[model samples]
Target chain A: MNIPLNITKTIHDWLFSIMPEGVATVTEWVIVAAAYLALFAVAGLYLVLLERKVAAWFQLRLGPNRVGPWGIFQTMADALKLVSKELTSNANIDKFLYNLAPYFVILSSLIAIGVFPFSRQFQALDINIGIFFLFAVSSIGVIGILLAGWSSNNKFAMIGAMRSGLQTISYELSVGLSMLTMVLLTGSLQLSEIIEVQRTGGWLILQGHIPAIIAFMIFMIAGTAETNRAPFDLVEAESELGAGFHTEYSGMKFAYFFLAEFINMFIIASIAVVLFFGGWLSPFGITDDITWFPETIWFVIKVLGIIFLMMWFRWTFPRLRVDQLLTLEWKYLLPINLVNLVLMAIIIWLNWTI
Target chain B: MSYFSDIYNGIKTLLTGMSVTGGYFIRARKGSITQQYPDNRETLKMFDRFRGEVVMPHNENNEHYCTGCQACEIACPNGSIEIVWDRQVDPETGKKKKMIDKHIYHLGMCTMCSLCVEACPTDAIVWAQNYENSVYDRKYLTKVLNQPGSKVKAGIED
Candidate 1:
């Protein structure tokens, strides 16, 4: 009756029982890595399909519905096409870095995903400074983008890479500050601990009140910019820069960049889920007595809701100008985020949280 | 201050835009205007004036409205229409009459301009709404409008 199912823990224990301690730990790590890799790949493909479907609905159109039932296999067909496509690139391109760039982008996202607490006791990695680790790993993707552009030997790619770097760096501040505001309320950087705090206190958004809402808004805007999606998508403005940093890439290399993007979106949405929406906690304990309904389902539902919001933002808002993007960060979001953080700290000091 | 007001206005406008899209998203099932092209072929209706292609209608008696006047041939800008004709002896009148041997239409060359249909004095040619015009061979596009042994309708010339 306490939602007493911890499947991941049982699996961990069973693995240890069958092997020596060190070997068991190594095997567990391998299994977790493989599971996460599979999850990331599938999630990326489905997220792409979801984005297209949502975009169609917004524009009063019918999206892809031919390849499979309701077009479920459309992205799978796209993956096959990309795989069969020839890997074409300029002869003057730096071969080593050009080949290495996509892995950097994809690997960073995969690493960031490992720390997410999908449900109680379901996290692969539970590091003490989990949020900080996420921030650090997520930024490594920009290095990959920069390397790709520099090695591509194309002017547009170079300009796009520069824009991406500028955008990521500027928005990273607001993202961190907004998150730091919530860290004050929960008093921990570890994701699981943050969620555990929420289990009793209700969602952080409700507990911290006005400042929490402000931080949530700022976080969403900055998170969207960090992912380099539309509205802040100056990095690959097709009308201006022509496919951006991945301009010279083709076949699976281009697929890597594209997949990394959606995975990064999932990561951001997951973080928002953990920090503000009580991670896997059922709302108001309405279904606490129902043992059949798992906490992981609740977690996934929250993440998807946030992902839909981000997609809505992408389809609704026009891409911001480069200067306007910078102004929004420096002139508006940064100041507001900093003030919101302090207000959160003050509210915490006075024991004013609900 | 204007600075705070700007922030407030920006947030308001963004929410307003989101609400519009959200409203559509909720009603998206009923609101979508897309026509499933191949699937709805049975129920699909083309407009009355849609000039998909040119066709010559034949009556049950194998008689058509064309008088072999060659007006459509001359009116066609692309020369898509060709009328091959011969002077045949009319047994009833005991006189020579212009009759069509072949009424060739080159669908490949046609721009669907409807000029030939407009030029026909006897309303012989009209637009057909069949849009699936693809063919594996170019020869398939060149169609003869009049069937074999078909003759001009009685009193059509007068």
Candidate 2:
């Protein structure tokens, strides 16, 4: 059950031999951080395309097809137009916070990506408490929104931001607790460890238990709220508020908020993919047997599917009222999540290990 | 009892939504019956009597039915029409006559109302079914119907 001392010594020597100099360590962090930012941008653009296509499918109308094949480059054209647009603070707003708000949201969203494990060894920094770290980074995104809303000094902006903050905070409890159940089962907060647990044994969804099923459902609905997507996008209700928080801000600054939102949508979907569906691991022995098949591609497909599903939910359903949204969280979801947490702890104590 | 009732209610609600969608799903084949004017304008080829913008049909003389009576201008609420004129010499009678110099209509301001056409003494201008009127440059918008080079022969025919 244990490694021989001689074999362990040899492995240790091999590891140290591949280790780089002190300057190389700094370069490694810089490369990973830069890569994370690039991935953040790519994920944002992909979400925009997915949203449009999914919306079109639901509404029974062609969304965007002129820019490129399947309207893939429509977001790029939109970005170009936004870039050329005049940055106007035509309405009076707290200039400093209003300008800085979008960056804050983008930063928080991008940081959350660091904690998501794309593939087993493909993560930037395999932080030990990855799940906790992800939730923490995501929770901080509301601060930027709140600042944007409050600083704008517009009633609509303030109301929208306040709704966003409350909805996020309320739903996150269920989302975080649901994630905690999986972390409890694996006994590790690291996402890679959770995926490995699912792969060798089976995906948690296949593990037949009432609590796990309930938790999965709660996690998905909560994740939708976390994204501020439809059925919960009271924050940016165009009918109610002109544009919510970014009503006053125009040009690239407004665009940044939009991009951050789509990126955040991906972050939610990625977490769902990692925690529930086997992350990077194929559905059956089908993928595991093929050594030539890349795990990263499988992982990307699953994440993209999750994003598409979120986009579908946004377009297929009407939005929830502010009171209804809060009620769903407090009355139904929060209780279910708490029960799931308690039940999961019992399952773990019973040593339900495959 | 409550749990069963709730489940029943959820099912009923879901079926109701599906029914509404089902109706549209069936009718989606009809596609709102819109012309998609930009892409398929050539194929649909609306008839000349489509009641679009009015065009002054020019004869061999290019003389339009508009007599510069300000009827269309007065009828228009949006101030989209301009009637200009100059005196012309009647070759037969050797008399000065008020002739239409130009009729400039800004389609941007025109609401496509048939009032001007209705008020016309002569039925020279009628709806031409030309709906593609998007343009840039507000100054270029003010169109002159009777351009400078238009040799409109207003001489009476036998």
Candidate 3:
């Protein structure tokens, strides 16, 4: 894989030369972790504002222009309000797991974001099992939802948790299978390597063309379900479940669950961009000649494009019925995903990818 | 196959729905229905016939047409209007007259029913169309319709 010039390397090299190796290594890890956390905290806040604005636009209304210019600080205001709220609790519930759940959910999403190749220079880490790591870490969030529901001692929360559990379990297969279809073309599990392959072959969506399109469609559908977003958002189907698994959580704890959701959405969109669209790779290599334009700009644009698509899906589509949610994954997505995978295998065997 | 067509139809419908939202998102700049209420207050004009609150109209000379007939006071279902009058001698007619001292309109009790406006014989009271009548204290809602220093206009026949 091509190691692009990264800022992290400069910092690491400088630190190693100046300080003892053990102290330098620890300090570098701390700096990187703090940087990622700070970046995502800001990203999470704005993403909520973006979703609100997009939803308003879809409904032909102007959203939240009161807090700051075009209501950009609306989520910041919401965060402040949420932090000051009381941690209301039911006396009979299991207190330990109920309290622990939101942190679990938030941490899982936060950890997955570390592996994303924002730009070649901006990646937190380029582990060989990057894609695998993301999938594994992200799924752990379902356990948090399950714990929150069970410990809440509420029937609606339990049902919502159960729905979330079943939905994530079933849809994850499709998410894996569809992503694997693209991975087949890249011939690597590492996300950076996948992007490196796309750099030459163009976007995987354009390279594999039809099958890639199919896989894209499947991946998006499953990823939406995995994130517990709408169309597949039967988990918090508010009409039925009354705010779902995080129903009992209040104050800062509830905010953790809420923030985790937007962060998870970002992670999903980032993955879609890295795998299908060329991550940090300019379209048609148009910006390659312009030395001044940063590669991270391309990555951000592509990620935002995918996110807009996801938000559009959320606002347009109605929530699926519990049975329909399962059927969509099992009957529709699973079958099409398998067929698409086979078609991709054949194409790869024939060396037909661009 | 029917199964394949089902999948195709599903995706087709999804795309169709997406396009509808996408169309709105694109056209939102010009088509947004939000009025930005407080910001647009200077330009916003309520409908002419809007029944906001009852007001007694007067000319610039502070001469109103109310004769203290108590027609509106009787007509109000919720006892929202009260006309307090004192007997005074009319200089022209040399007769005792019920001249209004204060016309009390309890807006807190008003439902904008327009019954009082319809019941007035002299067309003394009409809808002001000033809907932003909200106040912190309930007592502040009880407004005097007639401006201070207003008096009943002198008439020929009455």
| Candidate of highest lDDT | 1
The window of 10 residues in a row where model 2 chain A has the poorest summed lDDT is A1-10
lDDT of candidate 2 over A1-354, digit per residue (tens): 112234434644555567766655665667667777787777777778777755554555556777788678998888889989998874677889988898899889888888776665566668888899999999888989999998888999999999999998899899989988877777788888888888777887665266677777788889999978887889889999989987877778888889989988888878888888888788985766665566777778988887766665565567899888988789778876887788888876786644
Name model 2 segments beyond 4 Å from true: A1-20, A84-87, A90-96, A342-354, B1-52, B67-79, B82-99, B118-122, B129-132, B147-158
A210: Cα error in model 2, Å: 3.0
- Regions more than 4 Å wrong, model 3: A1-6, B40-47, B58-63, B68-103, B129-131, B144-151, B156-158
Counted clashes in each candidate structure = 0, 2, 0
Just chain B of model 2: what TM-score?
Answer: 0.76
Q: Highest TM-score: give the candidate number.
A: 1
Ranking by lDDT: 1, 3, 2
Q: How is the predicted docking of candidate 3 categorized under the CAPRI scheme?
A: medium
Q: What are the interface RMSDs of all the models?
A: 0.8, 4.0, 0.7
Error of 2 at A183 (Å): 3.1
The order by descending TM-score is 1, 3, 2
- RMSD (Cα, Å) of candidate 1? 2.6
Model 1: per-residue lDDT, tens digit, A140-166?
999999999999999999999999999
Summarize candidate 1's per-residue lDDT along B70-113 as a digit string, tens digits.
Answer: 99999999899999999998767888999999999999999999
Q: Give the Cα error of residue A129 in candidate 1, in Å.
A: 0.8
DockQ for all models = 0.70, 0.20, 0.74
**C-alpha lDDT (0 to 100) for residue A266 of candidate 2:** 82
